[model samples]
Structures are given as structure tokens and as C-alpha cells.
Target: MTLSAQLGIIVGYLVLALLIGLSAYRLTDRTAADFYLASRTLGTVVLLSTTFATLLSAFTFFAGPNIAYHEGPEWILVMGLMDGIIFAILWYVIGYKQWLLGQQYDYVTLGEMLGDRFGSGLLRGLIAAVSLLWLFPYVMLQQVGAGTALETLTDGAIPYWAGAGLITAFMILYVVLAGMRGIAWTDTLQGAFMLVVTWVAMLWLLTAIGGPTSATAALETEAAAHVALGSDHYTPQWMLSRALVIGFGVAMFPQVNQRFFAAGSRTVLKRSFALWPILCVLLFVPSFMIGAWAHGLDVTVPADGNVLPIVLTEFTPGWFAALVIAGAMAAMMSSSDSMLLSGSSYFTRDLYRPLAEFSSRDVSERREDLLARVGVVVFATAAFLVSLVNPATLFELGDAAFSGFAQLALPVLAALYWRRTTRAGIGAGILLSQTFYLLSHFTTVVPGTYAGWTAGVVGMALGLGATVGVSLVTTPAAAERRALYFDGNETGAE
Candidate 1:
């Protein structure tokens, strides 16, 4: 397709998104709950669609398929299919508990619930800090993806910086003007478009590459001896370890946590989680297949990561290819909006609120919502600047940033089920785990960091141990505070 036609497609998509954002403005409530949580009024269909679409981002559309092309079908087994199942299970097992508590406590951010549970502002502050820190890099990822997509669509006439800037501007405008209401509705439309594009691309790729049997045979026949599973590489240990690192670390990310908390009810959350696996299968199965098919077509893999886009252009028609490119933009922007909103919430509620000593009870909720909107602009600006430099550092920062947050997941989970978990203990655990995880992440000599997943594991272990030990040594939180943390409802007689 010519550059003019591609620009037309891109403009049309943006206009459609703008209309949705404008329409949702009336649906938005003036209060903090309305802006941030949608007044807990999200129905099953809206919640499910938004969550699924939000989760499917630039990484899923691009890198996921690229992994399959380079690594063969085993990559699907190792990362693609299993990753979806893990998310589904997480929703049921871990997410349900969070939903149950969020409703009872009327929590907006995960940090808010943590602060209340642990009876410590500092702990909540730390969670907020970690969330904001990690989320910057995530926003950077979307910025990079948007730049890449536009460059491809415009045939490099629009540079990466210009494209990223445009995306960042759109995100800040929509999020600030409409808040979560704007983001949720935009995600609904963007996600549906991506879904259509994915299936169309997949079907065409399969036909162009021959049937399933041919694709499978070609991959197996061309497999490198060194790269094959059970060789020096891709062994049982290597395979399982890689899967666990990508699965667990990505799952523990706070952006996903925001989605879980956004869910209005336990039933809606459960149904969404259960249905996510099917989407994962449908979206990725074809991408992985296309990756393998590339081997037979003798197409030089672009940048190791560019394989998916390369194959799309090579095999699909121009108009269809342009649509898929626009879909990539949709996927990237959906995740960006979610991450920016989450980061802003953490900054406003967890960081600035405590440090400024504002009483949540006394403040006008409208003012609080305004602060969150301002924070979104601040975060997006910083992310755009960071995109100007080395983009890969963004993902590395993700690893370094969230080690602390991941450690607290254990204490947060513990506080729900274990009544005896004292504030002092949980607080100590959070400190110890974060300190150790950061130190370990920097030190290659440390065996744990090489393993990648060990940062969270080791951090959680140290944090938990120290927390429990400290609580036993010191006095517990007041009986009333303890009741609220453990059971969600206080029974005064107890």
C-alpha cells in the first residue's frame, strides 16, 4: 500500500478511538471512584473484553510470534500457550482473593489495600514507588512499539521520534480527559480490531506456507543440532527455567495487577481469566506457525525481533498488511494507556498523598482525580524522553524495577490468609526482600540473578523470614487494626 493510504487507515483508527473517548466522557463519574474504578460498575462483557485486550500488547503481537519463528514449535510449548494458562490460573487462584478484598475495602490501587493491611504508610509508599518505577520502562516499550509501527506503515517517512511523540500525546489526552472510562472503552475497540487482524494474518500465513503438516515437517527438518531440545541447549533444565522466568516475572507485573483490581466482581474476574487462555491460543498459535513457515521461505529474519512484521509484509496483501500494522498500533496503545493510568494512580495515591499528608477522607475526590490526571502527563513525558535513547534498557529496567514489588506479593498474599501477620513483620519483609533483590540483580557472581527468576524468589524468602521474625520479637499491631487486615470486617467482640 502507498504511504497516503496507510496514513488514511491510521487516521481513521485514531478518529474512531477519539469518538469512543468522547462518548465515554458522559459515562464518567465526577468522583475518584468513577474516574479510577469506573464506580465498580463494569459489567462482565466490558470487563472481560477490556482485560483481554489490554493484556494483548505490542509484545504479544510482535515478539511472541518472533520467538516462535526463531525457536520453532517448542517456543509455543515453552512460552506462548503455557503463558496464557498461567494467567488464567492466576486470575482464579490469586486474583479472586484480591477482588474479594478490593470490594470489601473499596480499594482503588493495590498499594492502597497494602497500606491498609500492613498498617504502615511507608510500606504502601514503597509499593507505589516500585510500581511507578517499573511502569516507566513499560510505557517506554509501548513508545518504542508505536514508533516501529509508524515507521513501517509510513515507509520510514515518519521517524521513530515523531511516531512515539504522537502516540504519547494521544495517550495523555485520552487518559486525562476521560480517565479509566476513556481507556476501557478505547481498549474495547482497539482489542476487537487486533483480534480480527490476528486471525486474518494467521489464516493467510498458514495458506501461504502450505498446510500444518508441511510447516511442522519443515521446522523439524531444519532444526539446528545445537538449538534442539535435549541438546546442550533447550534442555529440560534450560526449557523449564526459561518458561518459569518469562511466565512468573511477567505475571507478577503490577500492570496486570491493575487489571485484576479493575475487575468489578469475583465472577466476572473468574470468567475473564478462564476465557483468556482461548484467546492466547488463537492469537499466538498462528504467529508461532508463521515463524516456522519463515524457515522454509528463506526470508532473512529482521533484527531477530522483526521477523513477525517481515513475514506479514512478505506473505500478505498490501491492504491487509496495513490493517495488521494498525492493529499493532492498537495493541501497543491499549497496554500503554493501562500502564500509564496505573503508574499515575500509584504516584497520586501512594506516593504524593502520604508525603503531602493529605487526608483522603477530607480532600475533595475531584481534586484527587485531577492530581492523577496530572501525574499521567508527567509520566508520559518522561517515558517519551527515555524512548530517544537505547530502547532495550527499558526491559532491563523492568527486571531491576519490580524486584521489590514481587517480594511484597508474598506478604500481601500472606496478610489475606494469615491473621497473625503483624505490620512490623510484613514491613520488615518488604524492606529485606527489596534490598536483597536489587543487590542480587546487579551481581552476576550471585547464582540467583543468573537464574533470572531467583530475584523474586530470594527477595520473597528474605522478606518473609525477616517479617515473621520481627513481628514475633516486637509487639503486634493494635487488635482492631489486626482484625481489619485479616478478616476484612472487624468483629468488635473478638
Candidate 2:
């Protein structure tokens, strides 16, 4: 595509997103609940689309292909098929219960629900802190992807810093203006666009480069190792551990977790999960093929592994390439907006509320909304600045983010299901799990094989053990509190 055409396509997509945000703002109620959770009023289509789009971040759009380009089709088994089922199952298990509690208590954030459940402000703060630690990197992944994609597509016409700043600016504007409602509206549109464009681009590329059969034959003869697993790098243990980490981590992402409350009804949530795997199949199969085909074609992969832009520019027509780039931009923005909104909500509702002098009841909803908008600016700016450093490839940064969040999976499950779970037990589990993950991640204390097992999985095992052992020794939460979450019966005291 000509530089002007590609830039125009991308700018048009952003304008559409901005318009959606403005429309949603007109419809918004301007209350904290409405801003954060869309006033619990998302139907099946928007609910499913927003959740699916949010999950399919820049990592999925860009990094999936990049990994498949280098690591072979095993990336499909690890994230595409396995994570599809894993995240779907978690949505059913965790999301259902969370929706029930959120509806009953009118809770806006996970921290509020957990803190009230355990009657501990410290636990709430810990959850918020840990979520941000992981979420920040994930947001940065989107910024990095945006910058790299723009730079590659435009051939240095647009600088990396400007590209990152552009995305960050749009993200802050839309999120601060329309909140979750705007995000959901834009995500639904962007998700459908991305799915369609991806399939189209894949088909076009496959046809132009012979066919899938030809591509497969080429891969078999030239890049045979890319078709199979069990290589030195993709060990069985490594694949399994990586899958587990992404599965668990994705389920508990703050942006994702809050979607549980946004569902209009149980049926909406259930229908979304039912359709999730099918959507995964459609989106990922083509992505893997495109990457693998590029390898067979002997395309000179860039330093950052941005093979999609290179492939499109070389093989496709100008219009088609522009459309594909716009689709990719949509994917990044959709994920970025949700992350910005969720991160701000965590900071405002979870972190700030507890530390503030005023009672939550005394605080006005308007002020809470304003604080969250301020947080949107603050968090998005930080992520944008980090993206300028080019810390790592999209896949590497995402791996770290997912691993950190996965450590919370066991503790969350214990708190939700096990009546014996105590405040101290949950607290200790989070601390120890995060500490172990950091140690294993940054240092050589954990061996290669164990590190391949992923710091999150190892930490989760230890954390789960600590949670169970400590809870066994400590007092359980009072029956009244337990009944509130488990038995659906409140004692009026809590």
C-alpha cells in the first residue's frame, strides 16, 4: 500500500473508534457503576464480543504469528486450542459465581468483593497491587505492537514514539469519555472487523502464494521442524506449563474479571463462553498458517518479528494491505482501551478508596468517576513511556505478564470455593507466590527445566500449599460471611 493509503486506513479506523466512544458517552449515566461496569447492562452479543476482543490483544494478533513464525505450530497447541478451552472453562467456573455475588451486593470491582468477603483491607490492596504489576506490562505490549506495526508498514515515515503516543492518546480519550460502555461498543465493532479481515488476508495470501496444500508441501520439505513439536526448545513440560500459565492468568485479568459483572444475565455469560472456542478456532488457525507460510516463503523476518506487515506489503494489493493494517490497529486499540479502563478502576476503587479518609458511602459517584478518568490518563501515559524503550518482543513481554497473573489463580479459587480460606491464608499465598515468581523470573535460582515450567506455575504450587496449610491452622471466616458468598444468604451484619 502507498504510505498515504495505509495511514488513511488506520486513521479512519481510529476515527470510527472515537465516534463510538462519543456515542456511548451520550448514552452513559455518568455514575461510577455505569462507568466501570456499564451499569450491568450488556447483552449477549456485546458481552461476548467485548470479552473476546479484550482477550485477543495485540499479543494475540501480532505475537501469535510471530511465535508461530519462529517456534512452529506448537504455539497453536499451547495458546490457540488449549487456552481456548481453559479460559472457557474458567469463565464458566469463576465468572458465574462472581456474577451472582456482584449482582447481589452491587459490587463494582473485584477488590471490593474480595475485601468484603474476607473483611480485610490489606487483601484488597494486595489484589490491586498485584493486578497492576501484571497489567502494566500487558498494556505496554499493545503500545509496543502499535509502534512497531506502524513503523514497519509506513517504512519509517512515522516514528516509533509517535506511533505509541498516538495509540495512548486515543485510548485515554475514549476511555475517559465513555468508560466501559464505550469500550464494549468499540470492542464489539473492532472484534468483528479483526476476525473478518484476518480471514480475508489469510485467504488472499494463501492464494497468492499457491495454496495451503502447496504451503504445507513447502514447509514439509524446507521447514519440516516447524510442523512438529518435541524439539529441544518446545519440550513437553515447557508447552504444558506455558499453556497452564496463560490459561489461569487470562481468566483473572482485571479487565476480564470485571466483565463478569457486566453481563446482563447468567444466560448472556454462558452463551458467550459457549461461543468462545469456536471464535478461537476461526481467529487462530489462520494466524498460525500465515506465520508458518511466511517461514516457507523465505520472507526475511524483521528484528522485531513483525512478519505480517512484511508479508502483506510484499504479496498483497495496496487496498488489501491497508485493510489488514487497519484490522491490526483495531485489535490493539480494542485491547488497550479495556486495559486502561480496568487499570484505572483498580486504582480508584480498589487502591484509593481504602486509603482515603472519607467513607465510601459519603463519597459521591461523580467524584469516583472523575478519579477513575484521571487514573486512565496516568496509567496510559506510563505504559506509553515504557513502550518507547522497546523492552522486549510482544511475546516475551506477554509471557511475563501472564506468568505474574497466573500465580493468583490458586488463591482466587480457594477463596471462592473453600469455606476454610482465611484472610491470613490468602494474604500469605499472594505474597509468597509473587515473591517466588520474581525470584525465579529474575535470578538463576530456578533451573532451566523448572524455569521452563514457568515461574507462575511453580509459585502457584507453593502458594496453593501455603494457602491450604495456613488456613487449616487459622480460623475460618465467620459463618455469616461465608454464607453470604457460598450459601447466598446474608446475615445483615456484613
Candidate 3:
């Protein structure tokens, strides 16, 4: 297809997304809860599809395939097979607990839940701050993915920054028009769209190469190392640590965690997680296979680009290929819009509300509402600037962010289930584990691994140890605040 035709398809998709997102403006009420959690009323289909779309992002569409392209299909084990199951189990373990307590307490954000549990606003502020800090890269990654996909597909006529900035602007407007409701509704469309495109693209590529049998035969000759199951890059430690990082880390995402509060019922929540693994398998396998096929075809991808678009354009016809790449852009938009909306809630609920109360300032719901919208704009713009810098590859950037978020998982789990958990214990765990994890980023002198454990494993281990050991020695914050999470209003909730 001509560049104009491709741009038309891409631009038309972007406008459709914005229009769909904005259509929710009338349905959304003018309250913080409505804006943040869609008034806590997401049913199974919307919840399942939105969560599935929100979690995959540019990371899954681009980095996932890129890994299989360069390394091998063994990268499949890194994601769908392990991560899908692990994350689904966590949704039940952690999410169900949050939903149960959230009903009684009406908690809006994770930081609020944890802080109220431990009776420490300081911890709440710290948690919100850390979440925003890590969320920057993950948010920026969507822009990176969009930039790469469009730039590659259009042969740079769109330019990397143009694609990055276009998605940024679209997301900011979408979040402002409607918050959780808009994002979730649009996510259902995008989720289904991306899945169909991915599978069709994969099947088309396979058939174009003369069926799966012939494609496998070609791969064996051209990429012998990638054809087999094992890759030296995937050590047991790497696999285990990665699973933990993605499973626990993703649950802590402001976007995904916020979804916990949005579930209409325990059944909706349970069914969503139950279907999560099936969704993962449907998307991950085909996307990875498409990338592995690139090696068999001798496709040359740029250093910054991946195999998905390059291969799609090569194998599929002009209009179909354009739609496939646009579908990938939908993945970026679906994820980015959700992140901006959720990240804004973190700032307004956890930080700004508390600050206003502390200052003895009379703030209206209108003021908080405005602050939330402002938060969306600020996060979207900041992430766009970072995308221009192109600081790192999608995989590296996502992995670093995941590891940092995973540091919080252990402490969060302990606080929710362990009545013995104390303010000082979770506080120590958060500060110490995150402190060590951040140090490893700045200084290589801090060993990235010890005794076959990856840096993420070491960080989470520190958090778990500090939480359990310190809680054993410390006094509980209060029994009254802990009862909400305990069964039968037990006095031992302390």
C-alpha cells in the first residue's frame, strides 16, 4: 500500500479509539470513585477483557516477539506459559483479599488499603511515590512500542517521535474525557481487536511460508539454535525470578491493582482470573511464532525495531498488513490510557488528598477531580518525553520496572494475610528492599546476583525476611484497623 493509505488506516484507528473512549463521558459520574474505579461496577466480560488488554501493552506486542526473534521460541516459556498462570493465581490470592476488604472499607487505591491497615500515612505516600516512579518507564514503553511499530510499518514516514507523540496526545485526551469507564470500555474493543489481528497475522505468515510443517523445516535450517526448546540465556534462576517479577509485579501495577476495586463481585473477579491464562495462551503463542518465523525468512530488522511489523508487511497484503500493525497500536493505546488514568488516581487519592488534610486546607471534590485530570496529563507528557530519549529497549525497560514493583509484592501479601504484620515491619521491608533494589540500578558494585539468584529474587527475599522477622519483634499498630481484613472480626487481627 502507499504511505498515504497506510497512514489513513492508522489514523482512522486512532480516531476510532478516541471516539470510543470519549463516548463514556456521559456514562461516567462526576465523582472521584466514578472516575477512578468506574463506581466499582465492572462485570466479568468488561473486567476480563480490560485487564487482559491493560496488562499486555507494548511490552507483550513488541518486546515479547523481539525476544523470540533474537533468542528463540524458548522465550515463550518466559511469558505466557509461566507468567499467565502465575499472575492468575495471584489475582485470586491477593486480589480476592483486596476485593473482600475493599467492600467494607470502600478503599480506592492499594496505597490507601495498605496505609490504613498499618496506620501509617508515611508508608502510603512512599508506596504511591514508588508506584509512580516505576510506572513512568512502563508508560513510556507504550509510546516506544507505538513509535517502533508505526515507524517500521510506514518506513519512517511517520517518524518515531511522531508516532510516540500521537499516542501520547490521544491517551491524555481519552483519560480526561472519561477515566476508568472510558478506558475499560475501549479496552474491551482493543483487546479483542489485537488478539484477532495477532492470530491472523501469524496464520497468514505460516501459510505464506508453506504451512507450519514447511515453516518448521525452514526454521531448522536457517535458525537451528532457535528451533529447539532450550536457550543458554534461560537459566533456572532466570526463569523463576522472571516469573516472580511479572506475576507479583503486575498485580502491584496501579492499573491492574485498581481493577481489583472495580470488580462487581467476587464471581466476576474469579472468572476474570480463571480466563486470564486462556487469553494469554491465545495471544502469546502466535505473536512469538510470528517473530521466530522472521528468522526463518532471513528478515533484517533494524536495531530499534522488532520482527512483528517487518514480517507482517512482508507476508500480508498492504491493507491487511496496515490493519495488523494498527491493531498493535491499539495494544499500546489500550494499555497507556489505563495506566495514565490509574496513575492519576494514585497521585490524587494517596498524595494530594493527604497533603490537603495535613495542611488544614478546605478542598472540594471538584479540586481533587481537577488534580486527577492534571495527573493524567502530566504522566502522559512525561512519558512521551522519555520515549523521545529512547532510553532502552522495551524488554530491558519493562524488566527493570517489573523488578522494582515486585519488591512491594511480599510486603503487601504479608500485610493482608498475616495479622501479626506490624507498621514497623512492612515499613522496614518497603524501605530496605526498595532501597537495595534501587541501589543495584545505580551501582554495579552492588552484585546483581548471589548464589544463583537474580537481583529481583534477592530483592524480594530481603523484603519477605524483613517483613516476617521484624513483625515478630515489633508491636502491632492497632487491632481495630486490622479487623476488616480478618475473618469473623477476630480480636487477633492485630
Candidate 1 segments whose C-alpha is farther than 4 A from its true place? 80-82, 224-252, 358-366, 391-405, 442-457, 464-474, 485-494
- Residue 210 in candidate 3, Cα distance off native in Å: 0.5
Using lDDT, give the best candidate's number: 3
Ranking according to lDDT, highest score first = 3, 2, 1
TM-score of each: 0.88, 0.95, 0.97
Please list the residue runs of candidate 3 whose C-alpha ends up more than 4 Å from where it truly belongs after superposition.
Answer: 478-480, 489-494
RMSD of each: 3.6, 2.8, 1.7
Put down candidate 1 lDDT per residue, 150-180, tens digits, no spaces: 7765657988898889888877877777767
Report residue 282 deviation for candidate 1 (angstroms).
Answer: 1.8
lDDT of 3: 0.85
**Clash tally, candidates in order:** 3, 0, 0
The candidate 3 region of ten consecutive residues with least summed lDDT is 476-485
In terms of lDDT, the poorest run of 10 residues in model 1 is 393-402
Q: Give the 10-residue window scoring lowest on summed lDDT in candidate 2.
A: 485-494
- Candidate 2 has an lDDT of 0.83
lDDT of each: 0.69, 0.83, 0.85
